[model samples]
Target: MTAPAPSEKALVPFVSVENMMRLVHHIGIERVLTELTDVIEADFRRWELFDKTPRVASHSREGVIELMPTSDGEIYSFKYVNGHPKNMAEGLQTVTAFGLLADVSTGYPVLLTEMTLLTALRTAATSAMAARHLAPKGATTMAMIGNGAQAEFQALAMKAVLGITHVRLFDIDPKATEKTRRNLEGSGLTVMACETSQAAIEGAQIITTCTADKQYATILTDNMVGAGVHINAIGGDCPGKTELHRDILSRAETFVEYPPQTRIEGEIQQMAPDYPVTELWQVVTGQAAGRRDEKQITLFDSVGFAIEDFSALRYVRDRVRGTAFFQSVDLIADPDDPRDLFGMLQRAKD
Candidate 1:
């Protein structure tokens, strides 16, 4: 028997991270990650169809803030995130974020989500998705530099996407490394604690950097990297924060999420104006070559693009519909008469 659909007058649900977490947990992390990758890849292949722009950024003495916006004619989305590295010491998240999805036809918001957790998930998913194409075949071991909030997501994504079984971990703070290890205790992967970045990258086929600092700091030097290592540079996403040495970028073939934004935010920002690089979407769409040779060193210069958040928002919206958890507030005024904009105010007086 077919059930009747709910009418438009039916109240909509609003979801928080706690509610969304149940959805995520029930679906399993790998499945969610796979779906997100599929959506992002599909969107990237039709890059010309999107209304894209560089994110709007506001700078402060403590940190930098940003709003990443994008649309595909039907749905428009934006994420508000702040990058304050010093916040952790004060017991706050280094990067706290939230986002919205709107209907372009009317500029009506359809979904609102706390992106703090989703950002970590999507960032890791995007990295693994890019690595699927750019990294060398049969890549197993990964060295995670800068263990923090993003460390577990990175480890889980690599394990789910690339079949990684061994992870070498390192961070300036010992507690952070311990926390990462604790988070992945039952995730079915071997975790090794390393003393230095050199030891961490020691035979690792994949290297992920996710440090939270607001300066041009080089965590990985040219000498530490070996042939066929896929470097996922996630921390050096802003102008001043960098993980790889400039000389390392000189020797390796680098791929970026979006060329223009990455040019200003990725590690390549340290390089010359004409430094050659390929966009990951090109490789995803088979328009460019990836890992040309087994001996070639590759880097994925990640700057947390808007398209990723778009994908994440879409996923959350679809999953939350009819779930009775999401609460929808009246953000738009719908008057009975098209020309009665002033009538809405008069009704409140009654």
Candidate 2:
């Protein structure tokens, strides 16, 4: 006779990439971004309740692979992600990821899902959340310096969350800029394909740099950044990688997610060990200031953090419930008796 089916407790919910895409389309991308921003911001407000740590990374000349983990007493989560700048040259994704959520009490996974697209959404939402507090008032029109997989998401997040009405796109590869413009054709925001980074930033209040280079390079020089503009630098996320010139960091009042991690991987890695930077959580909780004055240069040196991933996973776990977006995977083995592990294996052999 065939073995009995696994118990409900032995199964875990899994969301495939296709299901994730369907879920996003089902809820609408802009609404998903807006809701994710709110969820992330809510977590930031209670940041002290979560256990945080820097991501463990394995670096190579070709790329970097990392494991980001965090817990909020009740639930535990971790994401396995990789960043390979050279992958694009080989027709592969520059980044890819998957994450899991588990119950802290039993240490058993409850949800597992692909994070490549989820990460893009969470990254954009986090940038918009930081900008909500830091960007200059009445800001519209953001310059997207790198029009790659993430460019359109960033533009749409700013529009949905901050009400930005226009986006200027630029890339060293004109085809990439054209791709972004084409994807955003009906996005309800004026999209301009710019000739240069300088042209992209002209008449734009917010400038976002998201290039994929594994070495030290200056995407934006000090002179290119005028006063009072908000710079969202997301490309520099590893030790040897950086996007903004060193002098620009000095001019802008920089903010970050976590000091320990940012000191090692973010644009601030170029600065001194004791570089004065405010934590974004402090700004979210009103303990510190954000965008203190109209003419102040505000820089959000975002180096994707684990808590944000945890927040995103938490959001997905909640949203996928009672929906067909996830399938149950028989991941655990439950024995008929607690101590019948050998008997269970023998019985399955029949």
Candidate 3:
């Protein structure tokens, strides 16, 4: 039932929504993204050290809920995230998440935190970080194909990580593009609202597609993509969902976070079972190549892997160490005697 006075080991540090925002403001959003990229990159560099598995999922007619778990030899982490493309229309976030980080040595949770905004941040950081390795040299402009909840975050992240100063935005809804434009005003980046995806990518060397839909929709066709440009496709994250046409995938050298998971949930789902794709970790660790030539096309088919979330938790653990942006909660059941479970329950009756 109830435990007596708890020790520090029984408490879990929690970062609430307000505290998460405060942390972002404290570190500055772009700066936080840059830092997160570093953290994620570090984890990727030692990719062989991680225990990797595909996220477990429970699907519903309305949406899908997933549990992404991973652990290194020293630390363990997992996240509970949901994807409901229709949530915004119901006055909710399209995606919401929370996660826990545990010490592998003791199997006790060390951190519990909100990851709804954090997911958006990590996804953007992951994309921009990949671009640093995959994008063509001297790339400065980006074409954002979907201007929704993730549009602005993707924009600023590319700026922070890649020094991209110009963003050309397009959306099926003009209002969404306007919202992104209004949000980015005076952010020291030139933001352009465009009427078409083709116009958006006119001079952009990096094209980012982040539309939220649960279907195999082609936001960018093969002809739309030119040589030497890096395409960051962030929206096609689940089964039956993809953004790039198959022709584009065939022509470009695709890099993914995890080949097994991406084959099921990323754009590669549309490709043949034997279709070749390199893991992004390989490219990052120099085990494989990134961009080979100025005329080579590079595509990062991102589907939000567990290792990235684990790394995000790692970053949070480091950032909130001495900061006031978290609260402590008694999460573990701490009894006077480890084996006296019934005794602990009986003592609460008094």
Candidate 4:
């Protein structure tokens, strides 16, 4: 006898924002970050095996909406994210997102989740992982240039992955820095609130910029960045939006997630179209050099990629096994007869 196909109710597991946060808390944020780092790094190590494509974007005067998709031959994942820098002024999140993971065998979704928080987690984790390879040895301090919603997450990720013991924060808005400082209180790190970006970078071996503006803006100048510092430019993640000065870009050995996407959306966009930049996955897999010398300046031009989101979804999928953090949703229709979908729908009217 032929076995029954999977039921619709058993197909897709949905993790709402509440449940996503619950799963995060259940696993503890730091542990989740660490595990996510591992999972993301694993994917990067096998980077050649997954499908890669630039995110599809629709631009508007206010912001842009994007869909990033990828497949690993066996599973597929996609994320829907929006970047509206002015949203905070209107009491909305600057970045909001959701994602789905599906099986390649049946093209059926296996998991769906709120990826706003997961994106923040994965971005930080990806940065910390890069720093682990590219930052100066014994790096103990990080200069956080934009202390917005992502600041605290970056701080914790750096602490967990790279052993950063202090974070010096400077934002254009002092209130944001203050908010980050308060949020990070008693997190086992000496948090310094600085008045200027120059002051924030002093003695810092790692510099992270996460500003949210859609124009070509220099949050850091060449003169401010000394040698042997790893700059994680998370903020310069869209066309016409950047955080580092062109002079700094000219000086640093820049690394990036996906060169094609970064060429349009990263600080590297400010450089020559043919500008040479190393892919971070090469360093992750030891195919390329990272931090070649103590005096060499290195930069991670991080424009979030689809594979990282895929890895995050994969992590959540694995973590929720045999757990109640996810609730199955009736997202698909399953009929007793494969060709009776219409009949099933008709029966539901009874």
lDDT of each: 0.85, 0.94, 0.93, 0.91
- Candidate 4's clash total is 0
93-145: candidate 2 lDDT, tens digit per residue? 99999999999999889999999999999999999999999999889899999
What is the Cα-based lDDT of residue 268 in candidate 2? 93
| Candidate with more favorable, higher lDDT: 1 or 4 | 4
Least lDDT summed over 10 consecutive residues: which range in candidate 3?
A: 1-10
Number of the top-ranking candidate, with TM-score as the measure = 2
| Model 4 Cα lDDT, one tens digit per residue, 178-239 | 99999999899899999999999999999999999878788999899998899999984788
Clashes of each: 5, 0, 0, 0
- Candidate 2's TM-score reads 0.98
By lDDT, rank the candidates, best first.
Answer: 2, 3, 4, 1
* TM-score on alpha carbons, each prediction: 0.94, 0.98, 0.97, 0.97
What does the lDDT come to for candidate 1? 0.85
| lDDT top scorer | 2
Model 4: residues with Cα > 4 Å off, grouped in runs = 1-10
lDDT of 3 by residue, 1-350 (tens): 45366668778999999999999999999999999999999999999999999999999998999999999989999999999988989899989999999999999999999999899999999998899999998889999999988998999999998999999999999999999999999989999999999999999999999998898899999999998899999995789999999999999999999988999999989889999999899989999999999999999999999999999999998999999999999898777788987877788776
lDDT, residue 306, model 2: 91
What lDDT does model 2 reach? 0.94
Better of 2 and 3 by TM-score: 2
RMSD of 4: 3.0
lDDT of 3: 0.93
